[model samples]
Target: MSIDANKELVRRLVEAINRDDAAAFEALVAPEFLLRDAVVPTPRGPAGFREAAAVFHAAFPDFEETAEDVIAEGDKVVLRWTARGTHRGEFLGVAPTGRVIGFSGMAVFRVADGKFVESWQCHDRQGMLRQLERAAACEGGGGR
Candidate 1:
């Protein structure tokens, strides 16, 4: 696929995540898709993506990610994005504190055959955790 098309594929991925669209995830991801990210436990295939998305949605029901920039070259696409959400469910052992949080991240994807073959994601996980911690403290609770 062309570089622009590959970039679009990633953009659609962000859209799918915002919509929590599982079918789109299946369509955009290759059967052998691989993920490199610390926030998720199991990091392989479309099911992994779905699980990660579910975790985020469970913790932050209003989660939304916005792509700030997208760049592509030689079968690789990089996306810089910002995500915001309200904590409503437990996450990473942290109990829900009903606090809104935002963080920025970037993901680099290797695309082939019009689908994502592999991706490496880096985001402000610490910031997310810290915000949740503060909210927990304010509410007289703690991470579980």
Candidate 2:
């Protein structure tokens, strides 16, 4: 596919993710797609990817993602994004603490035939952990 087409495909993928549209995500991801996440412990395939999204949706019911920047070259697209949400469900084995958190991340994706074939992602894991810690403390009626 052309570079523009690759970029468009990635754009739609991000839109689908932001909407928490599992079906749309499934359609856009190749069967062999590989997802490497910084926070999550496991590398994910399509099913795992879907499960990861479910985890995010469950933890942050009102999660929102904003794409700050995107650059495409050949079959690869790199994206920078920020996401914000409130903790309402379990995350990383922590109980719901109702903390609001935001984090920024970057992802590089390889698209083939308009489907995401592979992705490498890095995010502010330490920042997220700190937010969770503060929330837990608050929920425990302690001042940080």
Best by TM-score: 1
Give me candidate 2's TM-score against the actual structure. Answer: 0.91
For model 1, the superposed segments whose C-alpha errors exceed 4 Å read 141-144
Clashing pairs in 1: none
Across residues 103-128, which tens digit of lDDT does each residue of candidate 2 receive? 98999999887788888989887898
lDDT of each: 0.90, 0.83
Please provide TM-scores, in order, for all candidate models, with all chains considered together: 0.94, 0.91
- Local error of candidate 1 at residue 104 (angstroms): 1.1
Lowest-sum lDDT 10-residue window in model 1: 135-144
Query: Model 1 reaches what TM-score against the true structure?
Result: 0.94
- Each prediction's RMSD to truth: 2.5, 1.6
